[model samples]
Target: MTPEEFAATFERIRREVRTVIVGHETLIDHVLTAFIAGGHVLLEGVPGLGKTLLVKTLAQSLELSFSRIQFTPDLMPADIVGTNVVMQDAEGRRYFEFQRGPVFTQVLLADEVNRATPKTQSALLEAMQEHTVTAAGTSYALEEPFFVLATQNPIEMEGTYPLPEAQLDRFLFKVKAEFPTAADLVEIIDRTTVADQPQARVVASREVIRQMLRLAREVEVASHVKAYTARLVRATHPGDPRSADMARRYVRYGASPRGVQALILSAKVRALVAGRANVSLGDLKALALPSLRHRIILNFEGEAEGIDADAVIQNALDETPELEEART
Candidate 1:
C-alpha cells in the first residue's frame, strides 16, 4: 500500500478504537504501531485503567482471530501453547494430536500476565520471537499477522511476578496507561452507564494489515539514521566509552539489538503514518522511550533512588547526536 493509503487505514482503525476508548491518544498510537509493525506490546498499569479494554477494543476494530488468556499463578506452558492429546480414529489407531492454544490466534490478549510464573511466561518467548511454537518434537508455524498484546500490572502490586528481562525484550513497545483526568472519568462513566454503550467497529482486514507491515519494511532508512539508532542503543550501556553520564551512573545493562529492531520498525510505521517514504532521524528519537524503556535495567543505585527508565533514556538522547559525523 502507498503511504497515504497506509495512513488512511491506520487512522480508520484508530478512529474505530476511539469510539469506545476514552483519552489515550499516545497509548493507542503506540499499540497500533506495534500491531502493524509486526511486534508484541506490553501494556502496564494498575487495575481499572482500561488496559484490557483497550486491547479488546483494538481487536474489535480488526478482522482477525482474537483470543484472551487470563494468566494466573497456575497457568502453565501447555495452557498457553497447547498440549498433545492422544486421539483414536474410527480405524482404532491412536495418535498424538496437537491442539493449538490461544497463542495460535492473530490477536492474543494476555490479561494479567504478571500473575503467571516465569516458566509460564517464558512459553510465549519462541512464539513472539520466531512466530512458531515447538511441542512434542514438532514446530507449529503461527499464521501471519500474529500479535500478542499483553496486559500487566505493576510488579509492586500484590501477588505479581516481575517479567524476566527475556520476556520484556520480546515486546516492541512498553506503554503505561495513566489514570484518566477527572473530566475524562466523568465522560467514561457517562458512556458506560448509559443504555447505548460505545462499541468499536471493524475497520481493517487481515490482508490490509499484512500489506501495511510489508510497506513499513520497505520504507527507506538513511545510513545516518541507522548509525544514530546504533549510537543511541550503545549509549545506554554503562560500559560503553560513549555512554551518557546518567546511563553510566544509573544503568546496569543496555538495550539489546532487538531494541534497535523495535525502534526501526516502529519508526517506519510512524513514518508511514506521517505520509513519509523515508524515515527521519526524528522518528527514531520520538520513539526512543517506548522502544527502549523496558530494555534497560537499572543499577542498584538507580533502583534504590527510584529513577525512572524514561529519565535515563532522555539523558542518552541528549548525549547522542543525530548524525555521527558531518559530511559537509
Candidate 2:
C-alpha cells in the first residue's frame, strides 16, 4: 500500500480504539508504531488506566487471534510456550503431541508480566525476538504479525521480579500509560456508568498491518539523521562526552543496537502516521524516551539518588536534540 493508504488504515484503527479507550492518545500512537514496526511493547502504568483495555481493543479492531495470560509468580515457561505430552492412540501406542500455549495467538496480552519469575519471563524472549519457541529441541514458528503487549504496575515492586535487561531489550518501546484528565475521567464515567459502552469495529486485517509494516520501512531518512540516531543511543553510555555528569553517575549500561533500530523504525512509523514520507528529527525527538527508556540500565547510584531510567533518557534527548537536527 502507499503511504497515504497506510495512514488512512491506521487512522481508522485509531478511531475505533477511541470508541472505548477515552484518553492516552500518545500511548495509543506509540503502541500503533510498535505494531507497524513489527516490535513488542512494554506498558508501565498503575491499575485502572485502561492499558489492558487498550490492547484488547486493538486486538478487537484487527482480524487476529488474541490471548491473555495473567502472569503470576508460579507461572512457568511451559505454561506460556506449551509443552509436549504423550497420548495414547486407538492402537494403544503412545504418541508425543504438543499443546500450544497462549503465546500462539497473533496478539498476546501478558498482564502484569513483572509478576512472573525471571525464568517465566525469559520464555517470551525467544518468541519476541525470533517469533518462534524451541521446545524438546524442536522449533515452532509463531503466526505472522505476532505481537506481544506486556503490561506492568509501576507502583508495585514487592514480590515482583523485575524483567532482566536481556529480556527488556526485546521490546521496541517502553510506553508509560498516564492517568486520565478530569474531562476525560468525566467522559469515561459518563460512558461506563451507563449500560452501553462503545465497541471497536474491526478496521484492519493482518494483511493491511503487514503492508503498513513494509511501508514504514520505506519512509526516507537522511544519512545524518541515521548517524544522529546512533550517536544519541551511544551518548547514553557513561564515558560519552555528550552524556551529562548525572548520566555518568547513574548509568550502568547504555542502549544496544536494537535500541537505535527501534528509535529509527518507530520514528519512521510516526512520520507515516502523520502523513509524511520521510522521517524528521522531531519524530526522533518525540520517540526517544519510549524507544530507549527500558534499554538504559541504571547503576546503584541512580537507585540511591532516586534517579530513574526515564530521567537519564530525557537528559540524553535534551543534550542531543540540537545536534541531531543540525543537518536538517
Candidate 3:
C-alpha cells in the first residue's frame, strides 16, 4: 500500500475503535502500531481504566479471531496454551487430542497477566517469540497474525507479581494506561450509561492488515536516523560514559537489542501513520518512552527514590538528541 493509503487505512481502523473508546488517542495508536509490527504489547494499569475494553475494541475493529484469558494465581500453563486430552476413535482406540486453549486465537487479551505465577506466565514465552506452541511432544504453529495484548496491574499493587525481565523484553511497547481526566470520565459515563452502547465495526481484514505490515517494513530509514536511534538506546546504559546524567546515576541496566528493534519498527509505523514515506529522527524520539520504558532497569538508589523509567528515558533523549561521531 502507498503511504497515503497506509495512513488512511490506519486512521480508519483507529476511528472505528474510537467509536467505543472515549479518549487515550496515544494509547490506541501505540497498540495499533505494535499490532501491525507483529509484536505483542504490555499494558500496565490499575483496574477500571478501560484497558480490557480497549483491547476488546481493537480486536472487534479488525477482522481477527479474538479470545480473552483472565489470568489468576490458579491459572496454569496448559490453560493458556492448551493441553492434550485422551480421546477414543471408532474402534475404541484411545489417543491424546490437543484441546486448543484461548491462546490459539489471533488476538488474545491476557487480562491481569501478572496475577499468574511466573511458571504459568512462562508458557507464553515460546508462543510470543516463536509463534508456535509445543505440547504432547508435538509442535503446533499458531495462526498467522497472532498477538498477545497483556494487561498487568502495577507491580506495587497487591497480589501482583512483577513480570520477569525476559517476558518484559518480549513486548514491543509497555504502555501505561493512566487514569482518565474528569472530563473524560464524564464522557465515559455518558457513553456507557445510555441505552444504546457503541460498538466497533470491522474496518480491515487480515489480508489488509498483513499488507499494511509489509508496507510498514518497506518505509525508508536514513543511516543517520538509525545511528541516532542507537545512540539514544546506548545513552540509557549507566556504564556508558556518554550516557545521560540521570541514566549514569539512576539506571542499573540499558535497553537490549529488542529495544532498538521496537524503536525502529514502531517509528516506521508512526512515520506511515503521519503520512510520511521516510522515517525521521523525530519519529524515533517520539516513540522512545513507550518502546524503552519497560526495557530500562533501575538501580537500588533510583528505586529507593522512586525514579520513573520514563524520566530516565526522557533524560537520555535530552542528552543525545542527534547523531554524532563516536568519541575516541
Candidate 4:
C-alpha cells in the first residue's frame, strides 16, 4: 500500500472506532500503531474508563477473530494457552487432543491482566514473543496477525501480581487511558442511556493491515535519525555519560534494546500514517515516552519521591541532541 493509502485506511479505522468510543484519541492512536507495528500494547487505567471497550471497538472495526480473556487470580496457564486432553474418536480409539485457548485468535484482549497470578501471566510470554504456544511438548502456531491488548487497573494493587519486568518489556507501548472530559462524559451517557447506541463498522481487513505493516517498515530512516534514536535510548541509563540528570538521579535501570526497536518501528508507522516517506525527529520524540516508560526502572529514592517516568523521559529528550557536532 502507498503511504497515502495507508494513512487513509488508518484514519478510516480510527473513525470507525470513534463511532463507539467517546474519546481517548491518543490511546486509540497508540493502540493502532502497535497493531500495525506487529507489537502488543499495555493499557493502564482505572475501572470504567472504557479500556476494554476500546479494544472491543478496534476488534469490531477489523475483520479478524477476537477473543476476550478476563484475567483473574484463579486464572491458569492452561486456561490461556490450551492444554492436551485425552479424546475418543468415533472409531473408539483414544488419543490426546489439544483444545485451543483464547490465545489462538487474531486479537486477544487480556482484561485486568495483572489480576492473574504471575505463573498464569507467564503463559502469554511465549505467545507474545514467538507467536507460538507449546503444550504437552507440542508447538501450536497462533493465527496470523495476532495482537494482544492488555489492560490493568493502576489504582488497585491488592490481590494483583505485578507483571514481571521481562513480561512487561514484551509490550511495545504502555498507554495511559485518561478519564473522559465533561463533554465526553455527557456524550457517553447519552449514547449508553438512549435507545440508539453507536456501533463500530468493519472498515479494514486483515490483508490491509498486513499491507500497512509492510509499508511502515518500508518507510525510510536516515542514518542520523537512526543514531538519534539510539542516543535517546542510551540516555535512559543512569550510568551512561549521555544520561540526563533526571535519569542519573531517579532511574535505577534504563530501557532495553527492545525499547529502541519499538521507538524506531513505531516512529516509522507514525511517519507513514502522517503521509511521510521517512521518519523524522519529531516522530521519534513523540514516541519516546510510551516506548520507554515501562522499560525504565526507577530507583527507591525516585519512587519515594513520587517521580514520574514521563518526567524522566522528558528530561532525556531535552538533553539529547539531534546530532553530534562534526570535529573542528
User: Per-residue lDDT tens digits of candidate 3, residues 141-248?
Assistant: 999888899999988899988899999999999998989999999999999999999988989988888899999999899888888888888899998878999999
Clashing pairs in 4: none
The candidate, 1 or 2, that scores higher on TM-score is 1
lDDT (Cα, tens digit) per residue for candidate 4, span 1-328? 7888999999999989988988899999999999999999999988899988888888889978889999999999999998888999999999999999999999899999999999999999999999999998899998888999999878455767789999999999999999899999998999999888898888998888889888888888998898888888888999897799999999999999999899999999999888899999999999999999999999999999999999999999999998873121
lDDT string for model 2 (128-188, tens) is 9999999899999999989999999884567677898898999999999888899999999
Residue 171 displacement (Å), model 1 = 0.7
Backbone clash pairs for candidate 1 read none
Give the per-residue lDDT digits (tens) of candidate 1, residues 23-128. Answer: 8889999999998899999999998988888888887788777899999999999999999999999999999999989899888999999999999999999999
Models 1 onward score TM values of 0.97, 0.95, 0.97, 0.97
Per-candidate Cα RMSD to the true structure, in Å, reads: 1.8, 2.2, 1.2, 1.8
Off by over 4 Å in 3: 326-328
Model 1 stretches astray by more than 4 angstroms: 326-328
**Of candidates 3 and 1, the better by TM-score:** 3
